[model samples]
Target: MIALGVWQLQRKGEKEALLALYERNRAMSSLATYPELPPVPDELLFRKSSVVCLDPVRWDPRSGTDVKGRSGFRMIADCRTGAEGPGVLVDVGISDDFTPPAWTGGIVQGTVVPGPEQPTLVERLTGRAVAARPMLVADQPVAGLRQSAIPSGADVPNNHLAYAVQWFLFALAALTIYIFAVRRRLRQ
Candidate 1:
């Protein structure tokens, strides 16, 4: 029982450390600075000052409930350098625009803020505006030449404390059962 309790404490400590690391990373400046030019960085692996352009693509929206037991729209965008080079597929949120390329290409310039919320996307999935709407991709510009918003990494790590407590309770129950059994056998 004592050993189990100790293990639970250790697990809690590890989880705490992980949560702290994530928080620290989130607090860092959301700068999109990158040294490399053109050549696409690994998907979701970009540094600051990196320039990314998305080719025309279509994807589902994030807000709507999925009849097939899945929610969120799909947006497919191609990441690449120059006109013809290595291109990578970027799956962005449904609130983002991931429509096909128009006569004017979409270009976004900003410090690559790390995390999923670095580049915020907004779109109306339901209602009359949906069908005649532009699917927003991760890198696509929002609202006609307007800069996209980036969400803070505030709510990224969630429910750690609750999880730790649950684990601790389980360990405690196990210890209690063991002690009760031992006492009963001794009396017998």
Candidate 2:
């Protein structure tokens, strides 16, 4: 149990460092250079950029939410830096209505975010696959909808310290119980 506690403490440090890196990335301004369609590194997760929408925007009703906790949906569509193949998915903005925006294909600016894991509930609700991973969080409003806030790593809770304390307490309780049992046996 002591060893487990120590491990959790180490994990806490790692999580803190990761959170700091995320903050730094979020603070950096949008990169003037956009990389070709490929795997983006962790360092570029929150980097901002402009992308031209190549395909029609599709709504992902499953993962939509507003800053005010209102029900909404994000517009998802394939986009590229220029006329090219292998465009990436972009999350345009959140809208309360289901109507598609008139500006379907155009240059949109936004920050990049890691694509969410496949949400089974969303897929079931929309009857379609969730938007591709590593989608963009648009900085501009679309179809009279407001842009959702880009998630910062700081919002992630670091509870490893609390977990470590719980483990140590459990070990201490077990040790006290054993000592009491030994004393009673000796007295008897």
| RMSD to true structure for each model, in Å | 11.7, 5.8
- Kindly provide the TM-score of model 2 when superposed on the true structure, using C-alpha atoms: 0.72
Lowest summed lDDT over 10 consecutive residues: which window, candidate 2?
54-63
Off by over 4 Å in 1: 1-54, 57-76, 83-104, 110-149
Candidate 1, residue 40: the lDDT equals 28
Q: Per-residue lDDT tens digits of candidate 2, residues 1-188? A: 98999999999999998888878988898878554344566677777877777665354443576666665776666554455556667777777666655665677788877765445877869887544367777777676776776767866789999999999998999999999999999999
In angstroms, how far off is 46's CA in candidate 2? 1.7
Query: RMSD, model 1, all Cα superposed?
Result: 11.7
Full-model lDDT for every candidate: 0.41, 0.72
